[model samples]
Target chain A: MKTCYINGTGCISTQNTFETDFLSEVTINNTENVIYANQPSYKEFIAPAASRRMAKGVKMGIAASSKALKDANLTMPEAIIIGTGMGCVEDSEKFLKSILDNKEEFLTPTSFIQSTHNTVGGQIALGLQCKGYNFTYVNGAVSFETALLDAKMQIENDEVESILVGGIDETGTYTLSLHKLINLVKSEEDKPYSVLNSNSKGIVHSEGAGFFVLENEKKESSYALVEAVSLQSSLETEEVSDFIANFLEANNLKISDIDAIVLGNNGDVEFDDYYDISNSLFKNTPQVYYKHLSGEYNTASAFGFWIAANIIKNQDIPEVVSMNALKKEAYSTILLYNQYRGKDHSLIVLKKC
Target chain B: MEALKQELKGKIIEVLNLEDIAVEEINDNDALFGDGLGLDSIDALELIVLLDKDYGIKLTDPKAGKTIFQSVETMATYITDNRTK
Candidate 1:
C-alpha cells in the first residue's frame, strides 16, 4: 500500500498563520464572541478582476491552496478535494437578501452563482486549470476529516499521486446573529473567554481555511505521514475515551505511543467535557490546544491538523499552544481529536516522516 | 448626454466591481468586453441584470447585447432610447 504524506500546508486563521512562521506571532483574543480571520493580502495570489466576485471563503481557499501547492513545489495535483461547512456564506447571505429586497425579481447572478457549497473546490480547480477529480465534503464538523480520509484512501490505492485537500469556512453577519441567538456563540457577559477550563457555554465563533498537499512519496518538504483517520457521527462524552483508544488500537498504537495530543477545546463549557474525558486518558502525554488562537468553527480542526503536522515536522511545540507542562524530547507521533457540540467526533493520527 | 454617459460609467464600475478602474479611466468608446475591459460572459450576465433592474430595459433578443454593450457610449445611447425608469 502506498503511504500518504503531508508535504505542504497553508493555513489562514484568526492568528497570523499565513505570513508568519509556525505559531510565531500568536495572540489570545477573549474579548469578542465572534472573531474574524487575520486575512493576508490576496493581490499576490489572485487578480483583481477574478477576486472581485469571490467571497471571503473563496479568497481564503485560493490563497491557502496556492501557498500549499507552492510549498509542495507542485504545479498541478491529480485531485482537489475541499471541505466547507458554510461555503461562501457571505455570498449566500447577499443572494438571499437580494431575493427579499427585490421580491425575487431582477436578481443578479453573481452572488447566486458563487453561493454554492462547492464554490471553493470549483474555484480552486478553475484557478489551477486542473480538470482532475474535484470534490467538496460538507458534513459539519467532520468535513475536513472526511476530505482528509478520501485523499488518504486515494493515495493508498494508487489512484492519484498527489491531491490538494483543504477545509474552508467564512463568517457572515446574518449567520453570526443566528448563531448568537441559538446560544452557539458566547454571550457578551462571558467576555474574557478562554478555551481551557472556561465557564462559558458557547464558543467564540470564527472562520478560516487550511489546505494541505498530500502525495504518495515523502520528500524533503514532507511534514508527516497520514497514519490513520477515524470519524464518529455521535458519541457520548464517556465514549470518547474508548473511541480514541479503539482508533489507536486499530492502528497498532496505544495512549503511550502518542508523543503529543492536540485537543479541540473551544471553551464551550457544555461540550468541552468531551475533551476532558480524553484528557484523563492522556494526562501524562504532552497536550496541545489551538481554539484559543483559531477560534471555534466547523472546520476549526483543520487548524489543529496544521498544528499537528508542523509539530511532527519541526519537532518543536510552540509555548502558546502547549496545554500541559509535560514535555517530550521529540514529537514523533501526534494524535488530534476534535468535535463540535459533542458530535462529529474525529481522530487523526500523524507520524514523523 | 454627457451626464448620462458619466452615470453609465459609474453604474458599470459599481455593478461589475471594477475596483482597479476608475470612472475616468473607462473611455466612452472603450469596449466593455474582450480587449478593453477584459470582462467575460459572467460579467456580461451582470450587465444584463443591471440593465433590467436599473433602466427597466429588457433586451429580449440576446443578440442585441453584442451591439448595445459594445461600449459605455453604446450602452448609454441604448438606455437613452429605451429606458422606462
Candidate 2:
C-alpha cells in the first residue's frame, strides 16, 4: 500500500486553531451548557457575494478548506470529500421553522436547497470546478474517520493523487435546546465543564470544521505521514484494550512503539472510563487530549486529528493538551483514539515525515 | 416612489446580507437580477419571501418574478399596487 502524507490542515474550533500556532495559552473551560465555535473572519476568505446565501456551517467549511488548500500550495485537488453530522443545520432549522410558521406557503428555497449533508462538498467542488470523486459521510462520530479512511484508500489505490477532506458541523440554538432537554448537553449548573475531571453527565456540546489535504507524495511542507487508521462500530469497555492491542499487532507495532497517545475524554462522567482503558495500557507514554479545548460534537475528533498532526510535526505537545504529566523528549509517532458514548471507535496513527 | 425605493433597498441589503454594499450604492432603476445589482435566483426567492412576509403580496409563478423583480422601482411599484397588507 502507498503511504499517505498530510499536506496541510486547517481547523476552526472553540480554540484559536486557525492561523495560530499549536495552542500556547491555557484553555479556559467553558461553563455554558452548549458552546459555540470561535469563528474566524469569514470575509477574509469568502467573497461577500458567494457568502451571502451560505449558512454558518457552509461558511466554516469553505473557510477551513480554503485555508488548507492554500497552506498546501494546492490550487485544486483531484477530489473533494466532506463529513458532516448535521449538514447546514442552521439552514435546516430555518427551513423547517419557516415551513411550520408560514404553514408551508410563500417559502423560499435557499435554506431548503443548502440543508443537505453533501452541501459542503458540493459548494467546495463548485468553487474549485473540481468534478472528480465527491462524497459526504454522516455516520455519527465516525463521520470524519470515514472520510479520512476513504482518502487514504484512494491514495493507496492511485485513484487520486491529492484530495481535500473535511469534517464540519454547526450547532443551532434549537438543536442545542433539544439536546439539553434530553440531557445530552452538560447542565447549566455544571459551571466550567472540565473534560478530564467533571461530575457532569453530558457533554459541553459545540461545533467546528476541520479540513486537510492528503497526498501520495511527501513534500517539504508535509506535516506528517499517515501511518494507519482503524475504525470499529462498538466496543465493550473490556474489549477496548484487546481491540487496541490487535490494531497494533496488525501494524506490527507494540504498545511501547507509540510516542504519545491522544485520548477522547470529553468529561462525560458516565463514559470517560472509555479513555481509561487506553490510558492504563499506555501508562508510561505521554498522554494528550484536546476535547477540553474543542468541546464535543459528532466530528469533533477531526480537531483531535489536527492536534495529533501538529504534535508529530512540531515534536512538542502543547502544554494545554496534556492529559498526563508524562512528557516526551521528541514526539515522532503519535496515536489518536476517539469514541462518542462508546460507539464509532477510531484509532489513527501518524509519524513524522 | 423614491421613499418606497429606499425602503426596498434597505430590505434587500438586510435580507440578502449585502454586508459591503450601502443603501446609496443601489439606484432606483438598477436591475436587481443581472449585472446591475448582481442578484441571482436564490436572491429572487428571498425577495419573493420579502414581498409576501413584509408586503402581503403573493407571487406564485416563478416566471412572473422576472418582471416584478426587474428593479427596485418596479418591485416598489408592484408592491404598492398589489400588496394586501
Candidate 3:
C-alpha cells in the first residue's frame, strides 16, 4: 500500500481550536458540564443564506473543511467522506419535538431536511460543487475511524489523489437530557472534573468538528504520514494494552519507539479505565490527553488526530494538553488511541517526515 | 391594512430567524425573496407554516408561495382573500 499523508487539518472544538495554536487560550472548564465549541465566526466562512438553515454541526463541518482546504492549498478534493455518530441531533430533536408538539400539522421542512446524517457532507459537496464519491459513516464512536479507514484504503488503491475527511457532532438539548438521565453525562455536582483521577459516573459531554485533508502526495504543509489505522469493536479493558502493542507491532514499531501518546480520557468513571490502562503501559513515554480541552463527544477523537498531526508538524506541545510533566525531544511517530463507552477503540500511527 | 403588514413583517422575521435584520427593513412592496429581503426556499417553507398557524391559511402546494410570498403586500393580500378563518 502507498503511504498516505495528512496534508492539512482543521478543528472547531470546546476549546479555542479554530486558531493556529492548540491548548493555548483554553480555559480549564470547571463549570457547565456540557461543553460547547468556541465557534468560529460563521459569517466569515459561510454566506448568510446558506447558513440560516444549517444546524451547528453542518456549520462547523463546512467551516473546518474550508480551513483544511485553504491550508492544504487545494481548491477541490476528489472525494469527501464524513463521520458523525449523532448526525444533526439538534435538527432531529427540533423536528421530532415539533411533530409531537403540534400533532405534525404545521411542521416545516428545514429541520426535516437538515436532520439527515449526511447533511454535512451533502452541504459540503454542494458548496464545493464537487459531486465526487461522497460517503458518511455513523457507527457510534468508530464513525470517524471508519471514515479514516475508508479514506486510507482509497488512497492506497489509487482511487483518488485527495480526499476531505471529517467528523462532527453538535449538542442537542433534549438529547443531552436523555443522556443525563441514562447517566451518560457527569452529574451536575461533579462540575470541576478531572480525567486522570475522577470519581464520576459520566463523561463531560461536549461538541466539536475536526476535519483533515488527506492526499497520496506529500506537500509543503503535510503534517505526517499516516502509517496505519486499526479499529476494534470490543476489547476487554485488560487486553487494551496488548491490543495497542500488537497494533504498533504490525506497523513495525514498538512501544518505546512512539515519541508521544495521545489518549482519549473523557472523564467517564466506568470507561476511562481503558485510557488508564494504556497510560500505565506507556508510563515512561510522553503522554497527552485532549478530552479535557476538546470535551468528550463521539467524534472528539478527530480532535486528538488533529492535535497529533499538529504536534508532529510544529514539534511543540502546549502546556495545557500535557497529561504529565514529561517533554519530548524531536517529536516523531505519535500514536493516537480513542474510544467511547468502552467501544469503537481505534489506534492510528503517524510519523513525522 | 397597515397593522396587517406590520404583523406580517414581524412574523416573517421571527419565523425565519433573521436575527440581524430589522422589521422596518422589510417594506410591504419590497420583494420578500431574491433581491429585496433575500429569503430563500427554506425561508419559504417556514413562511408556509407561518401562514397556516397565524392566519388559519393552509397552502397544500408550495409552488403557490412564489406569488403569495413575494412580499409583505402579496402575502397579506393572499391571506385576506383566502384565509379559512
Predicted complexes: DockQ each: 0.80, 0.71, 0.74
Model 2 per-residue lDDT tens digits across residues A131-165: 99999999999999999999999998889999999
Q: What pairs collide in candidate 2?
A: A31-A192
Q: Which tens-of-lDDT digit does each residue in B29-73 have in candidate 2?
A: 898877888998888888989998989988888888999999998
lDDT of 1 by residue, A277-319 (tens): 5458999999999999999899999999999999999899889
Superposed by TM-score, candidate 1 places the C-alpha of residue B73 at a distance from the truth, in angstroms, of 1.6
Candidate 2 segments exceeding 4 Å error: B1-3, B60-64
The C-alpha local distance difference test score for the whole of candidate 3 amounts to 0.88
TM-score to native of every candidate shown:
0.98, 0.95, 0.96
Sorted by TM-score, highest first, which candidate order results? 1, 3, 2
Name the candidate that leads on lDDT: 1
- lDDT (Cα, tens digit) per residue for candidate 3, span A233-311: 9988998989998897788898889888989988888888888755477888788888878778889889999989989
- Report how closely model 1 matches the true complex, as a DockQ value: 0.80
A138: Cα error in model 2, Å = 0.2
The Cα local distance difference test for each model comes to: 0.93, 0.88, 0.88
For all candidates, what are the clash counts?
A: 0, 1, 0
Give the per-residue Cα lDDT of candidate 2 at B55.
Answer: 92
Q: How much of the true A–B contact set does each candidate keep?
A: 0.74, 0.79, 0.74
Q: What value of lDDT does candidate 2 attain over all alpha carbons?
A: 0.88
Give me the displacement of residue A298 in model 1, in angstroms: 0.8
